[model samples]
Structure formats: C-alpha cells, structure tokens
Target chain A: MTDNTRRRFLKTLLAGGGLATLTGCDYLSEKTWFRDTLAQGETLSDVVQHAVTPRKAMAREYTPADISPSFRANGTTDPDAVEYRMLAANGFRDYRLKVGGMVENPMTLDLAAIRALPSRTQITRHDCVEGWSAIGQWTGARLSTLVEQARPHPDARYLVFHCADRYGRSHSPYYESIDMEDAHHPQTLLAYELNGEPLPIANGAPLRLRVERQLGYKMAKYVMAIEVVESFDHIAGGKGGFWEDRGYAWYAGI
Target chain B: MARARLRTVYRHPLPVRIGHWVNALCLFILLLSGLQIFNAHPHLYWGSASNFEAPWLSIDYHWSRDDGYSGRTQVYGWQADTTGVLGASPGRNGELEGRAFPSWLTIPGSRWLAMGRSWHFFFAWILVINASLFLIWALFAGHLRRLIPTLEDWRGFGQSVLDHLRLRHPTGEAATRYNILQKLAYLTVIFGLGGLIVLTGLCMSPRMDTVLEPVLEFFGGRQSARSIHFLAAGGLVLFVAIHLFEVIVSGPVNQLRSMITGFFRYRDEPATDSATTRETRHDG
Candidate 1:
C-alpha cells in the first residue's frame, strides 16, 4: 500500500476503534457481569488500604480558623417524612435514637441521654463522593461508647444507620452501614452539633453520623436508628447504603 | 552499484510490548472516566476544603431565555467561553447539557459518576500493576539506563531539540537506540508525571490521606492534591500528544510495527565497507 493510503487506513482504524471502545464501555456498564467485574477494584482498594493503614488511623483534623465559612449541605437537606418534620417542629425534644438489632441491650436514648454519654468534638474535613470537601467542627457522643453500652453480639459485623430522610426522586430511605472497625474508631461519632451550634436541618438535624475516614455518603444524616447486624444483604437495596445500592462502592475508602 | 539495505533489529522485547499496550489502554480509559468523574463537581480548589467563594479552576454555565446556553471556563482569575466542550457540551441525546467535559470524552458518554468511578479504579489497579512490573523489568534489564541521559547526551541536547523541531529522525545504527531528547521525555513521563499522578490520586482518597499523611502535607491538602492530580494528568496528555506526533513524523508504520512485533527496520547506507564496519560496531 502507498504511504498515504496506509496513513489514511490507520487514521480510520483509530477513529473506528475509539468509537467502538466508547460504545462498548457504555454497553458493558449496563451489564451486571461487567459491573461486578469492575467492583473487584473496589474490593482490592479496601483490602490494600486496610493492609497498609492502621485500623485506628485518624482522619486529618483542622483548627477553628480552617473551618469553611459556608459548608454546602448535600443529599437530603430536609426530610419530607411527616415524623421528621414533627420532630423538627418540636426541636427534637422528644426525638429518640434507638439502638437495636443483634445487640444484647436494645437501648432507646433521647437527645439529652445521648448527649450525657461520652462526647467528642472534632474539626475534620467532610469529603463528598462528588469530590468537594468541607471542614467543620462536629460534637457528639462517641459511637464506640454507645456500641459498647449496647453490647453487640459476637456475630454482629456491621452497624447499619437508618436515617429519617428519603433521598432522590425514588424517595428511598437513606441508610448506610459500616464495619465494626470503623464503628469503634475514635473519630466515629453520633454527632448532634456542627460548628458548636445545634446541627442544622440542612446538614442533618437531631443527629447524624461522623464516619470521618469515609466519604460523606457513608456518613448517614438524620440517623434515627442504629441496627447491629451480621450482614446488610437484607437492607433496603441490599448493598449496604442507598448510594451503594445505586452502584457506588460499599467501601467508600477511596 | 550498491543498493541500500533494510536492516531489522529486535527493538522491543515481549514484556515491553505487553506493558506498552496495557499502559496505553489504561491511560485511555482512566483519562475519559476521570473526565466523567470531574463533571460531577466541575471545579477544583486548593488547600483542605473547597473554598466556594474562590476556586482555582471552574467550569460553569449560564442559560437565559434570550441567550440560550453559554459555557464559561475560569482558570485562576481569567475566564473564557468554552461552549460545546467545557461547561456545556452535547449530551448522549445530542442536546446541550451542562457538563464539564463533552459526552464523547467520557467513558459511558453520559453523566454517570458511579460507573465512571468503577471504570477509573479498575483500570487504575491494572495501570499500577503494569507500571510496577515494567519498572522492575526495566531496572534489571538496563532499560531504565537507556532512558536516563548521560553527560554526552546532555551535551547534544540542543542539537537534539533542533533536530526534533525539524522532524529529522536518526537513521541506521542511531535508530536502534533512543536519542537524548527521547530519554529525557520518557524519563519524565514514566517516573515524574506517572508517579505524581498516582500519588496525587492516592492523596484524594480519604483513607489514603490517613496512610499517606506526609504526602498530603507535601501537597498542602487533599484539594491541593486533587488540583495537582488534574494538572499531572494534563501534563501526561500533553506528553502523549507530542509522543504521537513524533511517532507519526518519524515514521508511523515503522514505529507501530516495532512496538507491536518488536522488530524495527531502518534504511542502511549503500553496502559500503565503512558503513558495514560502523553498523557492526554499533550493533555489538
């Protein structure tokens, strides 16, 4: 073939290949097998991260000066649920956080009861899955204190946080689950205050989780119940969290 | 009358050939999927948190009843209209969509951050493994040495630059080995930019931030690391453009064949005594 023809052929070939690849990716994304195959990367990341980092490694904390002036509240700002609105109307005075499931002691604690427990105040960055971050001070009772008091069963492996909000157009109840390791981490908290003030309704009023090491989605807001379970397979979408059920990685370490 | 001989040399080994193709594929998927992920936020910041008031770079769109759709890209303090590409682009349905990158540039060709992350992370693992293997092989096989420039190579750097600008590639024995410019560029892309991109990627991960706190500190913060990651990726794209341009200018068919089949063919001077002697010495 002439040099010009060869060059033309190569150009056409590259263009065809590129188009094919893009369409192929789109097609593969729709297939369950391809998505499952892709999920192996998430598994790998989780494993590698756990292997390299200390189990109790704390997320970086910032001072008051470093706190963002305006923290953008994402996901469910105001839960449309009637019960949530009623609780908000009463200033969450009668709000109760139920800790149950596979725990020996199923405890129901009110806001003051929860606040009476050992509390921690930390100023850490909240990283969203969309790639934005906000630094704010979070004050709440240590999740470990509650978990210890509840006395989880030996078989209990995950802590599922059932929230008051329903997310997106589907109106799916927002929920997230984390392993015992993260549940007991020093930074993990059932946060009730933001920037030293009561957590705003936009940010998640009454209470939210502060899983500092994970992305914001993993930190379920407006947490109404904490269920200790052996597995999250029977949960809402059966993938641990609302976003996870919608194709986000269950392990949000990355 | 003597005729010119077409001398062939085994330029690329099997491992190198495999690594090259794998790296190329990984880079393509990573870049497109990365763009898809970037579209979710469409802005970059510095330091720890995203200072919403001021961003290092941002892609934004404004739609008015009279003006229709207008896309704007702001870098530092400068702004430019980048419609049909950045800020607003043609979507899967061929309608204008407010997105950081065009649909054609994304993996799924739509706004799908979850699938995009899946693609990005999957290929990222492959890229890291492939790069690690290639680096080890290069180190032991003296391939790394060939990429590093010598004092002699540095002395000829100016000439090499001029030759490259003139599109004058080496011939005969010189074709078998990398030139000084090639060495430096390869070194930078392979070790400098490649390493930076991967490290910055890790820095973006909250979990990784805990493990690699020193690296996070070095980059100032996660947001800073993220900005640097995008810049490093841009640098890599630039390198690939120049690399492809060089390949095409020098000889695409020959270059492609060499990368694929490991054999490189170069035109030799007419079968003369002196030319034969010099070829033998260089090959040896």
Candidate 2:
C-alpha cells in the first residue's frame, strides 16, 4: 500500500511540472498588474522600514587591515585608451572634472582643487552585481558638497557620470546617471582612496565616484567627468548605466 | 569487502529530491546575496523608501591622533562607541562574478542574482507540488487516517508537549517514525516556507501587485516582502540546522536509506514496548 502511494506521489510531482510552464510571452502583451504596492498596507512596509532603518544607511565598514588585497576591477577599470595613459603618466595633474549642465555655476575643477574642497571619509563595502564584495576606507570630497558648490539649477533631477570606458563598438562613452535622492546621499563621494591609500590605477586612479547607496556599477569606477543633467535621455545608452541599458533595473536597491 | 545489501525499495522521489537540493542551493545563494543587500542598509522597515541614508543616523568616525602623525599611532574607532560593524564581503574572488542573468531569462543573471531567482522559483514549485502530492497521497492511502494519530495522539501529544516544555522525554513512547513534536514542527515549516516564498514573490513581483495586495498589506508592503523573505529564509535555515541534528541522532544511513528506498529497514533493538517493535536493531 505504502509503495503504491509513494509511486503515485512521485508521478504526481512530475505531472504538476507539465501545468503550463511559463512561456514568457504573455507578460508584455497583458495589462501588466504588478506595480501598485500601495493598496496593500505597503505603507506598513514603509512604517517598519522607517522604524528600524538608519536615518543614513551605513555600509559595514572595515579597517585597512580588513581590505581585500586583490579587488577584481569589474566593468571597465581604467578609462579606455591612450588619453587615459597620458593622464596616468602625468599623474592626472591636469585632469579636470567638470560639473556643468543644469547647474547655476558651471565649474571646471582640477584634481588638486577638488581635493582641496571639504571632504568626507567613509569605510564602506563595494557590492558588485557579479556576486562579490570588498570593504575599503574611501576618503574624498562629499558629492553633496560638490553639488552644493555647483548649485544645480532647480530643474536638475539627475547627476550623470560620463566615463572613458566603452564596451565593444559603441561610439558613445560609457556613462551612468542617478536621481537627485542618491545625489545628496551622505555616503556618496567623489572617492580618491581605497583602503587608506590613493586610488590605484586599475581601480580608477586619480578619481572615481562612489554612490554607495546603489550597486558597484553605479559607483562608476574610472570616472572622467561629472555632468549635472536635467534628464538622462541625451546620454549614451539612454537607460542610465552601462548595464542598465542592457535591461537591468535602474534601481538596484537590494 | 564486507557484504552490502540494498535496504528497501523506497527512496525520495527524483522530483522531490531535486526540489530539496535545489531549494537548498537557492536558499544558500539567496542568503549570501541577501546579506550583501542587507549590508547596504542593515536595518529594514516596511516602507518604499528609507532614510537611514539621512545624515543624522550616521555614526561618526574619528581618528584620535597619537602624540603626532609620525609619532604615536592613532586610534581608529567609532566616535560614539557602538559596534562599527567592521567587516568585508564574500565572493570577492571566485568562479562567479558579474554573471548577471538577463532580464528575459528565467534566472536573472548569467551567474548570480538572476540564477538565484530562477533556481529559487523553480525549486519553489517543486517543493509545493511534491508536498501537496504527498499530503494527498497520504490521505488517500489510509496513511493519514491510520498512521496519523487519534485520541491517543492527543494524549501522547499532551505528554509530548510537557516533555518538550520541560526539555524531557515522556515515558510512554520513544518517538518512532515521528513523534507528536515532529509533526507539529514539520507541518509548521511546510506552511511557513511555502507561504513565505509565495508572499515574498508576490510582494516583489511587479506583476502580482493588484491580486496579492492584501498579502502585502498583511505583511506590510513590498519592503515587508523583503523583510518577510529575509525572516523566512532565516527560519528555513534554522529548520535545516535542527533537521541535520535529528538526522544525526537517528542514524543517517538508516533514516536516509528509508527516505531514498521508500521502506524503513526492519531493525531490532531493545526499544519495543508498544507498536515500535521491541529489540530493534538497525542493520543499515
């Protein structure tokens, strides 16, 4: 009796697998009902998150001793090509990071000038989409401080990062952008250090942007310039980040 | 070599076994990646947006310079003196990195998040189907009516409750097959894990927003789904831990062989008093 029942159960398990396995074709054509989290006391999700959540999210920091020895540089590490080499050879002495477009004050600041600006230090982990992580002490000027200095125009809704790295035959440069909320985030910084030392060449030497709130790709290593844009449509890829253009979600909070 | 013999004709069905291991793997990956996500904001809440990113909640960091920069070493610590939660990350160097599954694919990425999702969802169906099938099969096969307890179960159950409450075993029966305690716990897990995945998937899915909004409300919201998912995963982990302990105590080969072969190896030891068969010996 038990034997018969067990076999039946096994057969049923397999049979259930045949119940219309997802064809993946219906989603785009349908009315698409999955967007409203508000109807359900999603407000409750909000309330609880607010209660336990930190006012400012802090990455689990580590001492220099805890920093990884070999942090694999993902995406594009050094900005592409010979111009970056020339800059690297000269220690990026004359490199300029411009924060214009949609800003009241268009400023062109050299590496030294930007470094001279008030800075913030944070020891945070860099979360990569590739399934790895690393903790490093990053010291640099707060991105907010720079945003304040640049005084973005009232309509500026996003901050786009223009980079020198590109994959394949794309004529446009590798670029990424984030909303104003991430823009003013306290952890966000134009980082110049990994661990307690200067940013290594393979790790975006001379400068990089760290929007700690998002994934590592959002951090945009090998960043060449900061563009304060009113919208992201005009930029390369148009979807936001190098990966985002490829169908990755714009908001990778988790 | 010593003589070895096949114990029974029963074993875990292939689909059930596949589901079990796949769920295990998915849960492991989810936990690891989930930890990385949680590290972004350790504490979670019920809302769409959280302000833990605000400046006020930030713990201050200060370096107390020794006598001088070149002289005494500085003390590196949090200014307020709570656990700095100082740590690094896992998977920094491994076979898997950036292998994000494509959006259109069943899994989410080539190797990481997407695959975890795919495995998790696929195994979820396996678990649900197998569990349901087993329950129905048990009911139809007279196993539920006969093997499942009676008034005796309640009495045994009361004593069992007392035993567990007092952290002692009852005198009436040493649990065979399964005790009252096992039934309650396993049933609870079956429900909890199953419900959690469904609830979380509903909460996370951009597609289920309207249909399962009540569920989201019951838990809280989308973020609540995340919270529940995390909690549920943690609970399943606990279940796995305790399950391993029981498997160890029960004699791994004997119990496992029964599950695999679908027949308990008849054994004789000095354990019989009621229906458990006295003088049972495990020869697996």
Candidate 3:
C-alpha cells in the first residue's frame, strides 16, 4: 500500500475517537461504552483543565530544628556520568543548569549566578505521596527569576525539570513539570542548599525544585536542565512525569 | 442443558442485589453531593473533581446547609429537579459532601448536613452491613477464589493485555465476561475502593484520622488520603460503568438473571466457548 493510504489507514485504525468503529460491541450501548471507556481513562488535556487552580495549596510550616539529620533520597542516589561525577567530586561548584525550550534566549546559569539572585529560605514539611513526610529548611533562588531571565514564550504553559536520576528498572529519566502558577509561586525555588550546607546527593544535591504546593515527587532532584513548553504532548509518554505515565495522576496538587 | 443448569444454581443473592442498589444509591448521592462541595470552590486541577462548574446546569438555592462546622453553603446536585423518583432528596450517608448540593445547578439546599450527618452516619451502617455480609458470603461461598483468578488466568490476562495493546478486532467473549480484564478491574476496585476507601474515610474525620494514620501514611498524607478517597470513588464509578457495559454486551437480561436469580444463562457459542462453560461462576 502507498504511504498516504497506509497513513490514513493507520490514523483511522489507531486514532482514538467515536464509537462507530467499535466492532462487535453489539452488547454495550455505543454511547455507554464510549463514556465508560473514555471517562475511566485519563487524558493529558483533560488533566490540564482539571488541574487549573484558584485554590491554593497550604504550605505546612515547621520549626527549624525539626530538620532531619540526613534526608534520605528515595531515588537516584548518584548521576554517575563523567561530567556529573566530575562535578560531584568537586561538590557541584562548576555545575550550571541550562534553561531552554520555547524560550527567546536559552541560557545556562551557574550555581553562584543562580544564588546571586534574590533568595528564599522556607522551612516546610515535604509530604511524599509514597506515605512519608519530612521537614527540611530549603534555601535557594526564586524559580520566577529563572523564568524571567529565560523569557518563556507566551504560549509556553509548563516548566519541565529534567533531572539526572532515572527511576525504577525502566532507566527512564526522572522528570517533572509545573504550570505557570506554581512555577511563579513565592515559595517555589530552585532549592540549592538543605539546612545550612550544600544539598546532599541523597536529597537532590546542587540544585532541585522546591514546589511546596505539591507532593515531594513534584520536586525534581539533581537538576541538569529546565524546559519551558506549550504542552506535554512531546514529552515522554506525553503525560508530563514518570509516575504519571504509569497510572499516577499528573497534577498532584496536594 | 445449560438453561436447566442455570435454573438450578444461584448467582446474585437477594441481599447482594439490595446492596447493589443501596451502593448505587449511596454513590450517586455521594458523587453529586461531592460535586456540590466541589462547586463551592470549583477549581479542580486534576484527579476526579474539577474547579469548573457547568453554568447551564445551575440551580440557585435560596438558603444554606447545616454542616455544624460551616454554614450558609449553597450547592446543587446533578439532576435538574426533584420531579422523578431518583430526583427526590437523595440522602448523604456517611459521605464526604456532608450536605447541600450547589444552588446554581440545583434547587434550594434541602439536606441539612446535620440531618445529612444522621443519614450519612445511618447509611454508613448500611454500607458496613452490606459490605461485611457480602464479604462473608463471598468468602464462605468460595466466591472470592472464583472471582480472583489464579496463575493460569494471568496468562489469559496477559494475552488480553496484548490484544488491548494491539487494539485488535472488536471486544469479543473475552471482553464480555470479567475475563482477565474483568478480574483486574474488579481487583483494582476491591483494593482501591474496598480497602483504601474505608481507611481514608476514617482518616478524614478528626475522630478517626489518628486511628487510621498509619494506613493513610502508606498512601501519602491526610490530604493525599482525602485525594485517594476521591480517586477511589471515581474508580468505583468507573468500575460500575464498565460492569454495566459488560452485562449489556453479554445481554443484560441473561447477566441480571444470573445475579438476581443466581444462575448465569451462558450463550453456547461452540465456535468460541473455551473460556468457561458453567451455570454459575459465582464470583459474587
């Protein structure tokens, strides 16, 4: 078959749409089946609309002394690549985070430059969706500054964080994203230091996201890059995050 | 011979039927009432609830609800009005929505959440009773083992997964019965709704949050537990929807007859009758 016909055929066969093509579904009412199937399955677009929020996430506050002696990192202990290990050996002094994707000027800012921007230090409870909680003092540059410097395109809606760690057995890159609102929240920061010292590898060392409004996983660790994009369509599996692709909700706004 | 066999065995217990209807009634009220609560804020970003409220479907109530904790709340349920049998005041039985449907899409807020609390607390007993009895019946009657598949069934499930992945031909008999697909779906609802729900529901209330804190932590936090409760409710609704479709696909009367009267009248398709041939696979 010609490429045109094959493409059209594939589109008709695989494209998700109406129930007219539901062969042999004589038992289920077409409408009922369609509704049940579609409603049960979460779509990326539907999720974005649902997650738009006027409702604010209350940040749980904590005493400075409540910080853990050592915050155990759940995933990605070390990014063993040559460049990352070299930086890790020197304690990320030379590390620079590149911010690009749908931006006017793609720029790389070093840790010092990022720290030079106005900073915020907030001691809040980090609630992990996996059923654990920790309180830590996070100090870093306001995320909004980075977004301002990068000057994300008008259509750009999500701020994607590309981390150095890979999750589970899939070896898939650990990444996370947030809408414009969370990206610019006052408490949201590119957390560089935990407590007083530089962030430990176990706790997303050098630079990590601190989106207090969301669960712990929303805070991408071992940050190597940030991408501002229009939608999550081109991202891995198009659902926005690693866990979200595997049946977990994408906008975990609690 | 199959019809005679079906005539002898029982499928859906009378009490189970009652529970089905009760559970249906409870969930409908819960979802709509929950929607009413959601309408109060109306800004959902993900999961089951949304912040957006349908304007055309708005009912402006003249008054407020009785939650004891909060007052002067206006909300509406999904249905247009209370003209029909199901439309009349649907009570909130131990539900999250407490009381009061949104007013924009509903009539006056009739349910006093205080009174709604009584109904909620009351129906909670109904739920517990129905669920407990169903559990006991399923266990004592060997229905759990029948419903939950074994290692052999996993292969069928895996094959079904590949079929679904391929998006091959229409949903055949394998799709009709609670095939491996059905088993997994049921298993999800069981673990999601049956277990997490009770645990989360307890966690939400100040009185019981402490008791169920450990279990709640297994999922996330108090807020996460509440979110899980909502997610599980959505999952249950999804399960019920697929289940009804499965029944309809195989012929509703034939499926319902088995549950109501206790024996499933299986259509003998000699061409594709290899899955299981029996009067009742009572995974009730």
Name the weakest run of 10 consecutive residues (lDDT summed) in model 3 chain B.
Answer: B42-51
Pick by lDDT: 1 or 3, better one: 1
Report the C-alpha lDDT of model 3 over A1-254, residue by residue, as the tens digit: 99699768757854443123222222222344443342232233234323442334435455776564556467677776677788889878888899999999899989889989989998866655433345678999999888988999999999999888777778898898888988887888999889877888888888999987666777899989999999987899787987666544465532
The CAPRI category of model 2 is incorrect
Candidates ranked by DockQ: 1, 2, 3
What lDDT does candidate 2 reach at residue A58?
52
Model 3 bad stretches (over 4 Å): A1-57, B1-284
| Between candidates 2 and 3, the DockQ winner | 2
Best first by TM-score, ranked: 1, 2, 3
Measured against the true two-chain complex, the DockQ scores of the candidates, in the order shown, are 0.88, 0.03, 0.01
Q: What TM-score against the true chain A does chain A of each candidate get?
A: 0.97, 0.79, 0.77
In candidate 1, residue B256 scores what lDDT? 96
lDDT of 1 by residue, A133-219 (tens): 999999999999999999999999999999999988798999999999999999999999999999999999989999998899998
lDDT at B176, model 2: 34
Model number with the top lDDT: 1
TM-score of chain B of each: 0.93, 0.60, 0.60
Query: Deviation in angstroms for B169 in model 3?
Result: 54
True contacts kept of each: 0.87, 0.00, 0.00
